[model samples]
Structures are given as C-alpha cells and as structure tokens.
Target: MSIISSTSHATSNTATLSQRLTAAIGASILGACLVYFAGFSHIEAVHNAAHDTRHSAAFPCH
Candidate 1:
C-alpha cells in the first residue's frame, strides 16, 4: 500500500524528469543543426556563384 504508492510516485517523477531532459537536448541539437546547415549552405552557394562569374583574364578554373 504505502510502500507501493511511494515507489510508483518516485518512478513517475524520474520518468518525467527524463522526458524533460531528453526533449531539451533534442531541441538544442535540432536548432544547432538547422542554424549550421542554413548558414553553411547559403555561404557555399554564394561562393560558387562568385567563382562562376569571374572574368576570363582573372580565371584559372578553365
């Protein structure tokens, strides 16, 4: 009775804490990846575009 309920209560609390911690870590990792990929992809596109537009005299890519 008392012992069983207390054990269950403790387990529930621990589970709740674990859920919150997992959600926080997942959100943080997702946000970081989104920011990094967005920034890197945009920068890469700009760099490639610039390289493609270089004048023939100054170009070594040909």
Candidate 2:
C-alpha cells in the first residue's frame, strides 16, 4: 500500500514539474518575441531600449 501511494505521489510531482516547465518556456518565448518586435518598432525610444537591453545581456543584435 505504501509503495503504491509513493508511486502516485512521485507521478503527481512529475506532472506538476512538467507543467511548470512548459509554462516557463512559453513565457520565455513570448517575452523574446516582444523584445524582438520592440527592437524593430517605429518608436525610436522602444527600439533603442531593446537594443541596449540586448547589448547589456551580451546578445549581439547586429
């Protein structure tokens, strides 16, 4: 009985971890898209800010 319960508990934890990981990846992709679009924005301030951010992160934008 204890073994069965422990197995179910582990499965539940794995599912929760997977869900969190998926959400984190989705959020990261969405944030990257926002930054990329902002870098190409017509607004000079937004474009500059994104460019600076990329440089600060050591991500070459050129």
Candidate 3:
C-alpha cells in the first residue's frame, strides 16, 4: 500500500511540473510573436523608442 501511494504521488508531481513547463513555453512563444509583430508593424516607431531609451540612459547613441 505504501509503495503504491508513493508512486501515485510522484506521478502527480510530474504531471504538475509538466503542465507548468508547457505554460511557460507557451507564454514565451506568445511574447516573441507579440514583439515580432510590433516591430514589423512599426519599425520606425520601435527604432525611435529604443533611441529615446538610449538617450535617456546617456548612452551616446551618435
């Protein structure tokens, strides 16, 4: 009985870990797509945004 319960518990933990991993992967892919689309849709806007950020940080973009 003890062995059976331990096995079951381990399987449950593995399933939970797998689900979390899948969710993380999905979120990363979605974020990448969003960034790609945003940059593609407005290349100049993105460039300006980065440029302003650099200037704000005093990076001497020129």
> In terms of lDDT, which candidate is strongest?
2
Cα TM-score of candidate 3 = 0.44
lDDT of 3 by residue, 1-62 (tens): 35554444444435588899999999999999875665455678876786776789998968
Best by TM-score: 2
Residue 56 displacement in candidate 2 (angstroms) = 2.7
Clashing pairs in 1: none
Candidate rank order under TM-score: 2, 3, 1
Cα-based lDDT for every prediction: 0.67, 0.84, 0.75
- Tell me the number of clashing residue pairs for each predicted model: 0, 0, 0
- Which of candidates 2 and 3 is the stronger one according to TM-score? 2
Q: What lDDT score is found at residue 6 in candidate 2? A: 41
Better of 1 and 2 by lDDT: 2
**Could you give candidate 2's per-residue lDDT for residues 1-62 as a string of tens digits?**
35554434444434588899999999999999997789779999999988888899999878
Q: Can you tell me which runs of candidate 2 are displaced by over 4 Å?
A: 1-18
Worst 10 residues of 3 by lDDT: 4-13
User: Residue 43: error of model 3 in Å?
Assistant: 8.9
Which residue pairs show backbone clashes in model 2?
none
